[model samples]
Target: MLVSNVYRPMVFGCRADEPLVEVARWMVDNEVGALAVIDGELVTGIITERDLVGALATSDDPASQQAAAYASTQIRTAELEEDAREVARRMLDAGIRHLPVQDRGRVVGMVSMRDLLALETWTA
Candidate 1:
């Protein structure tokens, strides 16, 4: 199965300058674990729940921080036609839970561990 087969449609994201509080609220409202950090049309980084927690724990004024401060600049992306199993393996090896799904250099969706595990159940 391709990533397109299992990935969730409509990538969730926040601007790099978005406040940490806003990012946290967005995650809660969207029911997502991570978000792509976009600067205009570019996907600059990825911010996960772990990042948020770490930032909150370390920062005296968490509200003053932005997504760019906590988001991981090194992000792994998955092609729409890439094998889903391989994507899962990549996530495992990278110690990441989410990957932005891209098509022709444009982000279209995101695939998470939950999606991959659900696929496992179906394919098994």
Candidate 2:
């Protein structure tokens, strides 16, 4: 199945200037591990629970840290029409749990590692 068939539509996102604390709050509220960082409808990067943890680990004041500090380098992404297994492999090789799904230059969804695993079991 293609990524669009199984990708999660409930995208969690943040802007560059959004504080880390706010990012953490959104993650908590959404019960998700990551958030896509968007700049005017384009996905610029992603921030994850691990990113927050890493920032906290490196700094004494995570609460004061900016979301941009923990935001990941721009990632390789998949189109919603790409195969699910292909996207899963890309995420696995990159050591990331989330893949932002873009359509015509705009993010439309996300596929998490858990979502892929779930798909595997369902198909099996």
Candidate 3:
């Protein structure tokens, strides 16, 4: 199946300098693992649950930290028309669970390992 068949188009995001606490709270409230770090129309990075844990682990004051400080800046992206399996393989090779889904250089959504696995499970 294509990524478009598996991924939703709701791209939840925040500014690069958004507070880490607020980032985590948004994830919790939305039941998501990552948030795209958006600056205008650009996706600067992605901040995940793992990033939050690392930030909290190392910070003396987690609340004072910003999402951009811990986000994965070397972003691995999946095109909206790409195959789900191809995207999943790329993610595994990069050792990442979350990837921004882009179309025409604009981030349209996100795809996660969990989303791909669920698709696999359903297809099987």
Candidate 4:
């Protein structure tokens, strides 16, 4: 199966300049674990639940911090056309739970480890 087959098509995101508190609220409201940090039309980084937690632990005032400050700029991504198994391997090797799916330099979706495991169970 391809990554596009199991990835969530609806990509949720927030501007890099957005406040961390607002981004956290968006995450809670949307019930999502991560969000793409976009600057202009470019996907500069990603902010995950772990990132938020870290910010909460370290920052004296997380609300004043920008989302980009907490985002992981060196992100590992998966291509839409990539094989599901390969993507899963990459995720495991990198010790990451979420991967942004890109197509021709544009982020199209996201895939979680849970999604891959669920798909594996379903196919099995």
Best-matching candidate per lDDT: 1
For model 3, what is the alpha-carbon lDDT of residue 61?
96
lDDT of 4 by residue, 1-124 (tens): 9998999987799999999989999999998899999999888899999999999999999889999999999988899899999999989999898999989877889999999999899999
For model 2, the superposed segments whose C-alpha errors exceed 4 Å read none
Give per-residue CA lDDT, model 3, range 1-124, as digits (tens): 9998888798999899899999999999999999999888778889999999999899999999988899988988889889999999988988999888888887788889999999999999
Per-model RMSD to reference: 0.8, 1.3, 0.9, 1.0
Question: Per-residue alpha-carbon lDDT of model 2 for 1-124, expressed as tens digits?
Answer: 8898888876678997788999999899989998988777666789999999998899899888887788996776778889999889988988889888788877777889999999999998
Largest TM-score belongs to which candidate? 1
In candidate 1, what are the lDDT values of residues 47-104, reduced to their tens digit? 9999999997999999999999999999889999999999999999989999999999
Better of 1 and 3 by TM-score: 1
- State the number of backbone clashes in model 3: 0
Instruction: Output the lDDT of residue 35, model 3.
Output: 94
Candidate 3 wrongly placed segments (more than 4 Å): none
What TM-score does prediction 1 earn?
A: 0.97
Give all candidates' CA lDDT scores: 0.94, 0.85, 0.91, 0.92
Candidate 4 clashing pairs?
none
RMSD of 1: 0.8
